[model samples]
Target: MQPGLKLSQKVFFLVAVPLTVQLTFVAMLGHLLDQAEKEREREGRARQIIHHVNQIHRIIIGYIAGVAGEGLIGGGSKLEQSYSLRAGFDRELPPLQALLADNPKEFAHLLRLQKKAEASAEKLKQVKRMFKHGGDLALAGELPTMKLILRDLISELEAILSEERLIERTSPKIQATQRQRVRELLLTGVILNIIISIVLVFYFNKSFTNRLAIMMDNSIRLGLGQRLNPPLSGNDELSHLDSRFRDMTGALDAAARKERAVVENAADVIFSLDDSANFTKVSPAALKMWGYDPAFLVGKHCLAIVPKVDAKKTMEALNKVKSDDANNTFESRVVRKHGEIIDIVWSVHWSEPDNLFFCVAHDITERKIAEQVIKEAEARVRQILESLPIGLMMVTLDGKIVLANKTFEEVFGFNLADIEGETIDSILVDNRS
Candidate 1:
């Protein structure tokens, strides 16, 4: 295995290993089958040779019997039968020779046997001509000599049969040896294939799972704010995945830092509450707004800092932001640690996964106080204006009335509410219509 091997290549190697072994096994099995076929063919050829040898041997023995059986049969029938036996011997000879032709030694022996048969033929012709012309008594001198020649030929053929039968006898043992070889080859092939597969699987599994474990450990370290492991030394998919994970972690860390800086430098109070509505985090502005240590506010219930009069409204605001991405904007009075109450306009957002409510509180106490003073001044002006106004009304640049005195209202039969947003053009058009 190369150090820089890719994942797909490793996977291919894992599959290819066993496949290669199986292919090799199949190739070897094919060779064995070929050998078995050849052996079977050789055995069949031997059996054919044995059959032809037996037929020839039987005809040669009959030849000897017919020649010596003159007293036991009529002369004419005996001569006819002798000729027929001679023809049978001639017919069987060529086929036996052909069968033995594959073996040089056997073919040479058969050639010699054919030559000896030819020599006996001349001797038989001479005796047959004597017996035919002069009858049974004429063959008395030649019978013993002719029988000797035929007997010698029979002796040689029997020797050949003995050798052939010996060969035939060993066929079963040879077949058994072939069978054993086949069984051994099949068993060896199976065992080798299994071993190859198991070894490769274990090796690939070890390497792959080890790398996966390292990647998993890196993820845990990242989550716990610990340093990550060094990048893996490969171009495999797992290594690529680990690199991407590191990149994502770097991006997330940058984003978190930016958010932290924003929260720290912000002038308004920023805080978070846990699922139990307990204060879990408070920004640095807590000291300026709440007049308390941010650490001191941790684990404190939100209602502790909320005035009783505004507690219900604050609870309602919290409920409004219950689901993820939901937000609520409202104003509530918060009690400072110094026991003073102040108005705060809150913008709250919910994050269900974190089970926290993120809130920004802007103190609106000064704005509310200024609003009260403006309303009081407007009331005093209205009193003075009502005392001396004679159909006097205040209008905006668009000729829409903004304010009207009682005198103006009585004369026009219109209050400021009726004409406050109406353009001069629309009002005149309405009056004409």
Candidate 2:
């Protein structure tokens, strides 16, 4: 995975894994909130049922006690108690019916309680009818049965209340269990996320550090001019960078080899001198030019081979090359290994990076000897031409008087320097007839 993935992709995966885990936990928390809302609604319904049953029980007790007003029996005007009791049952029945619709089996006991309440209400109505038609004695006779029915209704209503109370008591424990389960799930998810994050961080850090270390080692080797091995294999960015670095190093090495080839096979004596004018490198051509092995000349001063007469001039030229940052050409005589003197023309320049002077020396001894011979021949011809009885002058094919003897200068009233560049036609005697 490390080898195949890019750095950005790996970072995204690491970040997304933890975020995804947290999002899952957030979803679970939302579910927990929904469950809590449901629990609240169920609790409200249970409380409503308990309140309705309590009201029913109070109305039965008051009816038996012959009280009136609210749930009381005989406190209100004559028909008000009966009317109030009936109105109370009428108002409470709808909620009970709604509860029955939601959980028919759970509120089955309330159905029996409602039947008893209705029967007691009918019995009370019968006693009122007997009192109106059959007088006080008939009312007194129905009172015992009315009491018995009231007792049964009260018992049924109490039973419903007890059931509701039990449910209310157990609901909190159930909700607590659900909350604990959710908390455990959240804790487990958080722990798992942390563990995964740690593992991934360690894995990636180790992988990146190791690969970077290899690249750094390779860079150090390159700086020291040492050979390098192939870089580690991968398709990632670091791998590509390493590949480019290797190519650059290979190109530099090839260029160095080509330059060495040029210097080794050159005809002139190619060499480099240190800042102190000591020979640091000498090419193989030194053997043919200086009659000394290149190996023997390394570390020697540049003035070591220079004749005493030419040493000052060579040093001055070397200083000018360094100070001016330019190439310089000069001729000097050098003493060879077998004590033979050779004239050589040297071209030298300062190399700032190497803190050295690079020089290419060409042996010019044969050319110098040829030039000296020509100078002597010209002097002898001038002497001979001057000593002759007849004046003589030398001219070029282009009609330029290049040389005129002292006798010709006297005859023409002009020195050789005056007529040197004058055309021959301008200086010749007019002999045409």
Candidate 3:
């Protein structure tokens, strides 16, 4: 899971879980509210039925005591009391019927109560009729039966009241149970949320920190110039970075190898000198050119190998190369390890990054010897030309007098230096010739 999920996905999951839990909790709270509303409605209906039953009982008592006059015993006449009682009965009957309809087992008990109420209502009507006929004794005689009917009705009402009271008494326990369920659900949600949070934290921390630690160790190894293992693999950003780092290191290694090959196999004596003109590095060819190991030359000043007679000139050239930031070529005599003075032609350039001068020196001893031999032969030829008795001159194809011997110059009464580059026609007797 950790490998499959990205950092952002992990964070989103963490956030979404809590929101889902909250939504579920809200749903549960809504259900609890609905249950509470139903409990309140049940309690209200039971109280209303009890109130109606109580009103009916009061009217019955008033009728039996012959105090059913307006504001006499219960605040209305007997006929008015009957109407009020009927209204009360009418209000109470539907709920009772509904209760019996819902619970048919209670129908047997309610059937007896309903018969007694009907009998009481009939007796009430009779007593009212007797009063209208002025039969006071007959009305009085029917009072006991009416009283018995009222008693039976009251008893049935008391039974219903007892059932309502029992229901009322049990309501708190039911509410308590519901409340306990809500608390349990809440506690379960909290515990589950906490457990999920803990698991996410542990997984994320372990996974992220472990991978990051591996990357950190790899970076440290790279810094120390140590070999690295295969890069971490995944589609995550860190994995991509690690792969890119691997590519960069591979490129750098190839470049270093190529540079090392060039430095090692170069024919010229390649070396670098610091700003103070001291050698920092010397290639292997120095051993062949200077008869000194390359390692022995490092840290030595450039003038250390130059002959005393050429040291001043070499220093001047070095200064020029450094100040002008340009390539310089100069030939100078250097003393080898075996105490021999050899000629070498050097090419030097200043490097800004290392604050050093990169130099390539080529051994020019044989070339210098050949040049000296050519110079001696030329001097001998000049001596022979000067020793000639007759006048002689050399002219180029372009009609210029290129050379004239001392005797020729003396004979012609003209100096060779003055007529060397002059057109042969210029010195001729006839200018056109």
Candidate 4:
């Protein structure tokens, strides 16, 4: 119930709980985004690795196939052009070695594929040597058997390249699984955020607004001269206010007794009215001001005391005060008990809960004369400002003009109406300024 305790509860639920949930959600979302990005990059690398491996494999197969086809169909011109064949194999080996170094489990399979191509290269070298040393016709006789061996070796290499393609194809499914995990993490974060937000709103409402409502209700009861119990909730600021309200009720009782004793002894009349503009009570001061006795005013409507010419306006003003948040004060002609007219300033307070309000008044003929003098002075000042010859301008500290008189329009070529809300820089042709 202490003020500190109330603040601590607000901080715990509205600040601490929400901040913890937000940090946890942000951490989860950031981790998911990082993981998704990593998977995409890795998948791209995997495809690149496979593409390079396939390119080397293609060149190796094509070189060997070209040599075999040439020996079968023509002379060895195609085989000679493929010095590139040896260079391509040499270039591809180190990368393949590095790939296998990274993936030691894949080494044996890669090495098996490498060895198949190596065997075919050795066979082609032998066939090439035969053409160089043995006569062409004798080499031609040996070509049929060598050509068959070359065809079978090429088939084996193709089978190994096919296995590499299969491995590359699994990348998309791996990426998909990673994406689903990220989505789940994001959903969990959002759910946690919503739960924390609800708790924070509830804590704030209980800590501040609900407690203030309780305090205001107790104060209103005291205002109407009624007894109020101690607050049922926290002994914070609102509870202190409730204790003060109880003290005020006691004070009102003592004051009411003193006031009634004075009224009963007076030779004058004093009165109070309800919102329906009827008298609820009368004091001795009324007799001094209006020649009215307490007995004559009791249970009488207030319009009975007002001159008939001003009665409608006084009633309309009272109704306006009942509906508005502001209090109303006005002067009206009042009729004495014997019908003599007098002027008075009326003060009224409306209480919607109690269903009727109170009104009191005092003679205000001198104050009205003074107010009329002030009004005439204000009219003269307004006329002087309107008659000024020079253009008048009012600008804010930021150099934006808020008001400009008539002569300013001729100088600037714009009416105040056209440019009142616009910034100074907007009027320039080169707006960068």
Write model 1 residue lDDT over 42-100, tens digit each, in one string: 77777877777677666666665555455335455465475555587678777787777
lDDT minimum window of 10 residues, candidate 1: 68-77
Task: Return the TM-score for each candidate structure.
Answer: 0.76, 0.76, 0.69, 0.48
Model 1 residue-pair collision total: 0
Best-first order by TM-score: 1, 2, 3, 4
lDDT of 2 by residue, 1-433 (tens): 4676887787787788778888988898888878877886777778888888777676676665542121223233444465457677788778877865777654676778767777777776666666556555665676677668877887777677776787789889878877887888888887888898888778677657678888898999999998776686777788888899999999999998999999999998999999899999899998887888999999999899999999999999899999999998988888988899999998999989879998999999999999999999989987888898777887888889887777777877888877789897776688896
Residue pairs whose backbone atoms clash in candidate 2: 67-72, 67-73, 67-74, 68-72, 68-73, 68-74, 68-75
Stretches of candidate 3 above 4 Å error?
2-83, 86-123, 130-198, 205-209, 234-244, 273-280, 291-335, 341-357, 431-433
lDDT of 2: 0.79
Estimate every model's Cα lDDT from 0 to 1: 0.79, 0.79, 0.77, 0.68
The per-residue C-alpha lDDT of model 1 at residue 110 equals 71
Model 2 residue 246 lDDT? Answer: 93
Cα lDDT of model 3 by residue, 53-134, tens digit: 5665675565555532432333346547565655666776777677546545445556776676677667677766656654
Candidate 4 residue-wise lDDT at 104: 48
The predicted structure with the larger TM-score, 2 or 4, is 2
Q: Which parts of model 4 have CA positions greater than 4 angstroms off?
A: 1-4, 8-12, 66-74, 90-127, 130-167, 177-195, 229-232, 235-433
